[model samples]
Target: MDFSTMIGHDTIKNQIVNSIKGNRFSHALIVTGENGIGKSLIAKEIAIRLLGKAEEKQYVDIVEFKMSKDKKSIGIDEIKSIIQETTKKPYEGDRKVIILYKADGMTEAAQNAFLKTIEEPPRGIFIILLCEKLENILDTIKSRCQVYKLNRLSEEEMLKFLNNKFESLSEDELKAVSAFSDGIPGRAERFLEDKSLMEIRDTVIDILKGICEGKLDKTLLYTEFLLKYRGEWQEVLTYFLSYIRDTLIYKETGNKELIINIDKINEIKDIAEMFSFNKLNGIINIIKDTRSKLERNVNATLVFDSMLVKIQEV
Candidate 1:
């Protein structure tokens, strides 16, 4: 896709365009952002521009390196193959672009091996490393590349993007998507494509409403529901946190517009009336703590149980 069509990151796009125009584009570039933040899309756009090709046509000169689905880390052997490939001249254009997806997944050894090529890249070779974590890249490797970080879009920007992509969504749906996407375009797309995610979101909202209504006996039942979607526990927690945040916002501002879960305004109002600001804040804190614990590989069952109990107590 054209950079103009991409949502947000106008500054970075302009810089890239200017750099290409000036014929002073860096041989190695690093693109960093959280998952679903459009790092890959940006990298691909750069490749298309660099190769001077139409977006619909595949260019032989553009090479992408991605971690295998079965592999947790990109090993040294893969880097070696890429290094060998770099020795060959571009097949279809004057410039060859190597786009490494999830470059942070490269092991230290693989990074060190890959570093050799970027340190002294072949003529007309451009290396774009897409990473979620900048710290995972070697300092030496980072020093040799120009780093561009992608930040989350504003709510307004996200809403515009959603409107452009999905015309059928209602105003409330747009607002919910903008808030749920957390300003990430790719995430917003996922929400549009994955109906199951919407189901999970609804379930989480129901669970929160139950909690707000003092359904203590249903705590275990809620935990069981969460466990059923263990693979998506993070998403479940994010949904929980978001609704609680909306409740808190409503409680404090008394403005329906400020709430993210706009479709559930009535439930949010009920929640706001049922709890004080301190209690709402306490629940938010508890959700954050539970998320932290889950990230640490804590027992999911215990964490969920404890989180429900803590919320009830609050």
Candidate 2:
């Protein structure tokens, strides 16, 4: 998609345009930002602009490599394959571009193997690495590229885009989705297309209330039931954390505006009374920690079940 269709990141788009206009486009470029902040989207645009060819005609020269779906890391073999293919001339475009998503997930061997290629990149070759954190990438690699970070969209910008795109939502609904999107347009779009996200969010809120009411058996039972959905554990964890966060925030500040589960403020405030401030913080930390562990290829069921049991401590 083009910049006009993108929700925000106006400054990033300007920088890209200016860099190309000034003939300062780097052979190695890194676009780093949090998920759903449009780093990959911008990278694709940069590739297309630099190619100076139509997307359909030059599709052969645009290689997209990513971490394996079932694996945590990109292996050295994959990088070697890229190196072999990139050594050849472009099929149609002026340049051969490799869009490497999740490049930070590359193993040490792969990263070391990649250094030589990027250090002295071949003429008419562009490598773009999209990442969530700069620290995860090698310093030598970072030094070889022009790095640009995309900033989170303001709540106002996210809300404005949501309001303009979706005609059905009321002001409250718009505010709710925008806040729940957490400064990300792609997330807001997901919420708009799938109403069930809100439905599942409410169900998790109910489960949190069940826990607060000392119905531990019932709450864990619900968690087990929800865990049957193979890929939705993250979604469950997200809303659960949102509920716990809202409880802690509201408990500490007595502020409705800070809560993210906008549809059930009263229920959240009621649950807020069940925990001491320290206990609330403990639970929040546990959930956050579990999330981080899950990203490192940890067992989902164990992490989630342990999280449920640990919340009982508070």
Candidate 3:
């Protein structure tokens, strides 16, 4: 895919294009961001463009590796095999591109094994490390590469994309999609993939309604329902947060256009009026903190329980 096809991060795309155009390509580069933010897509696009080919198969010089699903980490042997592969000359071009997906999944030993090769990369060797977390990678590995921390798309950008993709989408649908996207284009696109996602969002709104309205029994039941789908806690948390955020925005600004959950304007209005402005911040923080913990692989039940208790305080 070309850079134009990839939504968001126009600045980063231009920077990469310019660097390659000027022949100032770095031997190693790190593309770090949350999943669904298009890091891997951008990396492949960069590799293809830099290799002077639009077709992936035509770029014989490019090699890619994803984290081995059979193991907890990328073993030292895997890294060594890649290092060995990098030693060979390009088959069709002067430059050989090494695309390592989820590079942070590399074991400590694998990272050490990779140090020498990345430190003094051979002629025509270009390495791209795509990772979700910068902290998981070693400083030695990080220092040797140009690090690009990608950001999410803006509300306008996301809305524009949704509008372009679904011509018949209503204003409320557009608003919900744009707001729930959390700046990730892929997350926004998932609305098109999964039909039940919006249903889940509506249920989350019901749980919030129960809690905010002091309907403890219903809220407790809703919480149980939420935990039943514990596997989707991440998606649940996202919609929950987005709904609350939209309500907060409406409460604070009194601007309907600024809110994301347009279809649930009545619900948002009712919920927003139930609490004062100060209470909203605390609730937002509680949910945001819970999301961070969940992202770090904490126990889902414990995190959700803790989050509910804290939110109840508001």
Evaluate residue 183 in candidate 2 and report its C-alpha lDDT on the 0 to 100 scale.
87
Largest lDDT belongs to which candidate? 1
Off by over 4 Å in 1: none
How close is every model to the real structure, measured as TM-score? 0.92, 0.84, 0.85
Off by over 4 Å in 2: 53-58, 194-196, 225-235, 245-260, 269-282, 285-302
At residue 165, what lDDT does model 1 achieve?
Answer: 88
- Best candidate according to TM-score: 1
Q: Candidate 3 lDDT, tens digit per residue, 184-302?
A: 87887886678777678878888778788776555666667777778777888778777778888898898998877777889999989986777778888888898789779998777
Backbone clashes for every candidate come to 0, 0, 0
Q: Any runs in candidate 3 off by more than 4 Å, and if so which?
A: 56-59, 70-72, 212-217, 223-225, 228-232, 249-255, 273-282, 295-297
TM-score ranking from best candidate downward: 1, 3, 2
* 1-314 per-residue lDDT for model 1 (tens digits): 68878879999999999998798899999999988898988888899988887664567898998889999999999999889878989997688999999899999999988987998899999999999999999999999999999999998889889989899999888988888899889888888899878888989878777887787998558888888877787778889888888887888788887887887888888877888888888988998999899989899999989998999888
| Alpha-carbon local distance difference test for all models | 0.88, 0.80, 0.83
Write the candidate numbers in order of decreasing lDDT.
1, 3, 2
What's the lDDT of the predicted structure labeled candidate 2?
0.80
Please report how far candidate 1 places residue 221 from its true position, in Å: 2.3
lDDT of 2 by residue, 43-70 (tens): 8878877777545333777888878788
Give the 10-residue window scoring lowest on summed lDDT in candidate 3: 215-224
Model 2, position 51, has a per-residue lDDT of: 77
